[model samples]
Target: MWKYLKIVLALCGFILNTMILHTNPINDVTNLISIIEKLRPLHKKLGKPGPHDWLAHHHEPGQTFQEYYKSNPMTPRGKRCVIYIQPLGEFTQVQRRIVVLTSDFMSRFYNLQVKVQKDIPLSVIPNKARRRHPEWGVEQILTSYILNDILKPKLPADAAAYIALTISDLWPGRGWNFVFGQASLRERVGVWSIYRNGNPAESENSFRLCLLRTIKTAVHEIGHMFSMSHCVKYECCMCGSNHREEADRRPLWFCPECMAKVCWATCSDPVDRYQILAEFCEEHGFNNEKEFYKKSIAKLES
Candidate 1:
């Protein structure tokens, strides 16, 4: 009777433990789904695309929060959690300042540690990969070389994503005028250029614009590294842009669905993430963006 009783108690404990393990993840998903619903009204659905808009050409079926969660998207895990930014070339004082601010925003955005590695000279790009644009006359470096030869070789074992930031212009290859950025999602590597983001030294407004553009590019590429597809459902940072006009029109914050993805991927609390982003936007004079983040926080908390 004693032996039978002990076995029954042990079995009960195992069943209880198993139930708890399953319960927690279900609770997490349920909470995330609730948050997504709460924030839905705050986001604008993607409008009809103009002639040159990204959606006009790309025709991608956007991913919903449910779909993204089901896809087993790549996420930072264990020791491989830091996002490293490698500076690929020279930057002006203003550009360097932009880089620092962008890094801070990225850390807050992803809830990950972001370290800016030391500068790497542009000379590392071979002559064959360098070209002077035939029609535009702007000097550009091949993006493939940077991702394949430079960043991939130096990719840290603990890096969730390794990205190169450069002031120089970037081109993927022949027939392309320029690319704002490029990345390998599965491999967790990317490169972006601030060449067209505008001259920060020109004026205060110019500096702000340049900083906003840089932050957008960095977060967008990093979003891809996390297996997020271009957002076609809303006016979001994850949405692809085919031109500077389209890019400038995009908000610095992710839409409701994409926001859910970010929070889920990083295992971040929605309220805390919004609060930090609001503070960052306020400090940087992004008044409009700050208000949006504040609204998100209020919605989540309520």
Candidate 2:
């Protein structure tokens, strides 16, 4: 089953790549390049990574706007533009609210329509695909099972990406412990666990933290689905993280280069995008992030 699934995924990637190559360049390429240049100084360069940081453990060449365009990266095109979110399993009132807000943020982030599907019960998972952590005694469902057996089979025809949002803990396989999320760039299927994102019912601060983490992971994985490599150029949300501290340290907004990629891919106006993002941050009390987006708008418009 695994082998067959792998072959199918590879074939899907090849077809997608072929489509990208034949697709015409985005009409606003020059405008996006200008926007990147305009906002360049406002973005900060990524510094040396700590020993436990993602970059320290994994070497990524990083993707620049030019490289991304030249490679004919995937974008939401034709009927495959909507991002679909499938909730798998139960959620507390707080967690459910967080998921709703995250979906709204994703819509604004990508400038695409987002649909939250009805819940798919956890009963679908079988015994072979679940385990209890030997050391921690925590229950976790197999991420591969969710990605392959569940998400891939039901992926909506109009979905550019179909992601499962779950409150259950997730494990990729035996060698690993737990993953916050996993995504198949080729298959456009992903599953994320909010079990480790902290209990949102704790306090207002905790709720905000949980929401921030959820938003970060959602956009990050979806960004991967768009053929975006990890951002090594700046302290952008696209930058990879190995742990919670590193993820928390990263900003919610993309850097100038990455911002351009999102704009070009979505055919969004940079100023308008920043404005909408800033409003979301303000509404959600993300004061710091709000200020950053506002500043980005200023830089671009200046």
lDDT of model number 1: 0.89
Candidate 1 local lDDT, residue 34:
88
Summing lDDT over every window of 10 consecutive residues in candidate 2, give the lowest-scoring window: 18-27
In candidate 2, stretches whose alpha carbon ends up further than 4 angstroms from where it belongs are: 1-27
Each prediction's whole-model lDDT (CA): 0.89, 0.87
Each model's number of backbone clashes?
0, 0
User: Predicted candidate 1: what Cα RMSD to the true structure?
Assistant: 6.8
Best by lDDT: 1
Measured with C-alpha atoms, the lDDT of residue 39 in candidate 1 is 93
Q: Mind giving the per-residue lDDT tens digits that candidate 1 earns over 111-174?
A: 9999999999988888998999998898999999999999988989889899999989999997
lDDT of each residue in 222-264, candidate 2, tens digit only: 9888888899999999998888899889999998888877877
**Best-matching candidate per TM-score:** 1
